[model samples]
Target: MLYGLIICTITVIIMSTVNIGLEFGKLDTEVFLIILKSFPIILIIAMLLEVLVIGRIAEKLVHTFSDNTDGFNAKILFTIFFTVIGMSLIMTVIGGMLGKGISPDSFGSLSHWPRNFSIALFCELLIAQPPARFVMKKLHLRQEDKLDYDFD
Candidate 1:
């Protein structure tokens, strides 16, 4: 859950920055304001979608393919694989609808769905997961040392 929150925070900011800039043909001060308006809605939905839906799917899939011999890296990779693919597919369309409304013309954005998926996959791989993993590791270490933390 903590891991998902960190990843969502990073990915939402980066994805919103890029997508909003593409929409307006250039970045400007106004884009950040728009993001501020939209960010909480997007982030909450994304966190719920990941935790409630995609994360469960990924865990199941990982347990299916993984054996006792598989290392932590392999399991983590499997989780990343399924989760990112699932999140990318759903969020691309959801993002469009949330931002643009569901007109027939809005469905035209499906044409760019592949591009959106590619960007999301790369962003998760290159930008979000690394720092999220780092934070989780630190938290785990703190836990092992008998330190207590509470997100709630």
Candidate 2:
């Protein structure tokens, strides 16, 4: 859960900025203001979508692939893969909708969704995960606590 929150927050921020820049061509003062103003709402929507929708879907995918017997690295890779896919899809749609609401000319079409998705996937896998994992490790949030149960 903590991991999910960290990843979702980081990915949302990066993806939102990148998508905004892609739509507007550059991040000038006006664009930055748009970002600053819209950020809170965007983040809220993203986190809700991630936690309530994507996380459940990713967990189901993960369980289908692994029986909880894989090594930690394998599990992490699976989680990251599923998460990147889930986040990219959800964010692309939501961003497009919000962008359209903000400026019809700027985000006029969904033609750029593929490009946006690729950039998001690449960033999540290559850029975001390393630091997020580091932070989780430092905070002792990476390790799962196993509970032993006995019936007599």
The numbered model that scores best in TM-score is 1
- Could you tell me the C-alpha RMSD of candidate 2 in Å? 5.4
Residue 93, candidate 1: C-alpha displacement in angstroms: 0.8
Give TM-scores for every candidate, taking all chains together and pairing residue i with residue i.
0.86, 0.77
Model 2: CA > 4 A from native:
102-110, 141-152
Measured over all alpha carbons after superposition, the RMSD of each candidate to the real structure, in angstroms, is: 4.0, 5.4
At residue 90, candidate 1 shows an lDDT of: 82
Model 1 segments beyond 4 Å from truth?
147-152
lDDT of 1: 0.84
Cand. 2 TM to true fold: 0.77
Please report how far candidate 2 places residue 109 from its true position, in Å: 4.7
Inter-residue clash pairs, candidate 2: none
The lDDT of each candidate is: 0.84, 0.73
Consecutive 10-residue window with the lowest summed lDDT within model 2: 143-152
**How many clashes would you count in candidate 1?**
0
